[model samples]
Target: MSDAGDKVARIRELNDNFRKTFAGGMMMMTASVAALPEMVRSAAWLKVSEFDAWDTGNDPHHEHDFINFELCNRNFFWKCDYYAPDMNSGSEDPSDPEKTVRVGLLMLAEDY
Candidate 1:
């Protein structure tokens, strides 16, 4: 094969590896949430992000942006929203003023 063909093959291999790793992480996250619904909910209230597979990367400037996860299970999907409590004018009670919240949402894919 040519050099370009070899490079393409390597890239495809890397992409496959990344996909598998990410999928495994998502499965683990789903299991964890299923096992500890209350804990997850409490953490959400506290704005404690970074669940097993998901991280919001909580940047203040991109609070409205979302890190999306499209799981293999077509029924479900996940997303982590970087939220700035202080910046939001709609809310009377915000969780944290200085730090952004990594709000994780797991919902039906159809609903999303």
Candidate 2:
């Protein structure tokens, strides 16, 4: 693959790792998600960890940064937003883990 393709692949792999392990990045949830029962919320988290439904329709950029799913008949989405290492602004190079800090958000679809 070309250099650019390799970079994007690395970015996707790092993003997926952050989603599954909540490591190397921060995680935030909407108020509605925070209000869910502990058991239900735990289940939802498991779903997030196990998510692997990416495709052209939902992941056109192929970054693996956003995901939408259903739980208990309710719509939900998880998103990863890239920021600078300082956490003050967007990253200049999202493909570089050292230059970026990822923030994952979990929220109701309506909240998106």
Candidate 3:
């Protein structure tokens, strides 16, 4: 990370790319989320990809790293965490994409 502003911007951009494109990272689903019917899971995933309701309440850090929403009357959440390239520890600098690996989870809010 560099200056606070630049660091936040970089982190936010990286996180948005992972969330929107599911590229540059991996996303895992909780067992309950994985067990959902295909169509429902698809819809829920679509919601996750489309989520952009950010503000002080849900995204206080402004990193675009996590959100919760309702799908089929069930609450669900998606979140991202930054790790080292080897996945053995937290990244030294989350804003440095080259030194970081992004991992995310999509699961029921209840499982959060």
Please name the candidate that would achieve the greatest lDDT relative to the true structure: 3
Cα lDDT tens digits, model 2, 9-72, are 9889999899999998899999999998888778887888899989999899889999888998
Candidate 3 TM-score over all chains jointly: 0.95
Put the candidates in lDDT order, highest first.
Answer: 3, 2, 1
lDDT of 1 by residue, 36-90 (tens): 4575434432332232333446323223223333333334445443345553533
Task: Give the winner by lDDT: 1 or 2.
Answer: 2
lDDT (tens digit, per residue) of candidate 3 on 79-104:
89999999999999999989999998
Ranking by TM-score: 3, 2, 1
User: Could you tell me how far off, in angstroms, the CA of residue 56 lies in candidate 2 after the best superposition?
Assistant: 0.4
Evaluated at residue 76, the lDDT of candidate 2 is 87
| Model 1: worst 10 consecutive residues (lDDT sum) | 19-28
Worst 10 residues of 2 by lDDT: 39-48
lDDT of all predictions, in order shown? 0.37, 0.90, 0.91
* TM-score, every prediction: 0.29, 0.95, 0.95
Residue 100 lDDT in candidate 2:
95
